[model samples]
Target: MSLSLFIKYIHLFALGLLGCYLLRYYGDLNPVLASVLCGLLFSFLPFQSFIKSTKGQGAIYAGTFAAMSSSRVLNSINDFVLVCILGGLILTLFEGRFEGLGGRKGMIAFLAVAAFYMYRSVL
Candidate 1:
């Protein structure tokens, strides 16, 4: 298969995995609701370039979902904080290491803080 086609399939697979993770772990909604919301969220993201680029978009989506999924299982504030910090760092390094997130430091920091705040409040 061509490389572009491979990347497209990878993106779809990642989005599917993210959807499943959300359906299973999302606390604010039922499984069906979570699936629908996840679908909407993924659909809203720009996919044209994502499908063509070999820049770890799939890993980004999957890692973000996995990190968010930890909220349902992490029991204590300490666990939550540690997971957020370490998971975010790991995901960022794993997915964004080569391109360095295209220099979007502010956006990355904002998402990290926002995720911590949301999970902390829920826990």
Candidate 2:
């Protein structure tokens, strides 16, 4: 597979695992906010160089946040803005809750996004 595709798959897998973790622990969190917190933590964490040396981790987090909020608003512009807002809210709500689990947060964010998409499609 091409490098980009490979990276995307890996990111997707990471998100899936994150979702499982969230389900196991903090599934009660609002999906949109959880995704934002996950994205922010993943982006800012200094462990990028030690493992998975790619900026895609940040993208995965951001994408998950976006996906989670995509269902609430239909307008494309509004959707993007809402995603960011939701993410921020999540970060604020669960501040310092998962200090050492950036990866787990990412998975939860992914699951939230997936759940949003699933709900949107079903309705």
Candidate 3:
């Protein structure tokens, strides 16, 4: 197999293992549960259809949600709400008119959330 493909598979395997570990050890954690629930809800919700309807928006939303799920501060509803709003605003402001590029919005959202978390940690 090509090096890139091997690396991709390895990364996927690692992620799968990590997810299993989290489910086993932190399954009872409220924040972890909330993130999972929110992720499911977002995937199924009709309102989020707009995101899927637009390629770039979908990417941004997915990226943001993924980042939020990985966040350490998403333990409370208030924190989650704030993060979501902040991510949304960042995408709206910086993503410009490219609304149909698949995953672009998600990438933007992920970066914004990551930046926010980094900033918070430094403060």
Best candidate (score: lDDT): 1
Better of 1 and 2 by lDDT: 1
- How much does each candidate deviate from the true structure in C-alpha RMSD? 11.9, 12.3, 13.1
Clashing pairs in 1: none
Residue-level lDDT for 28 in candidate 1: 58
lDDT of each: 0.47, 0.46, 0.45
State the lDDT of candidate 3 residue by residue for 1-123, as single tens digits: 244433332332223223323453456555435445544444565543443344333433343344434545444545544555455455445434655555554465466557667767888
Best by TM-score: 3
Question: Model 2, range 8-119, lDDT digits (tens) per residue?
Answer: 4345435523542353235656666666566556657665452243435543554454444333443354334333433333433443465665564455444445544565
Which portions of model 2 miss their true places by more than 4 Å?
1-9, 16-27, 49-55, 62-123
Model 2 RMSD in angstroms:
12.3
Q: How many angstroms is residue 33 displaced in model 2 relative to the true structure, after the best TM-score fit?
A: 0.9
For model 2, what is the alpha-carbon lDDT of residue 80? 42
If candidate 1 were superposed on the true structure by all CA atoms, what would the RMSD be?
A: 11.9
lDDT of 1 by residue, 15-108 (tens): 5445545565655565445645665566567776653354444434433444344444544546444434543454445453546445343244
Cα TM-score of candidate 2: 0.36
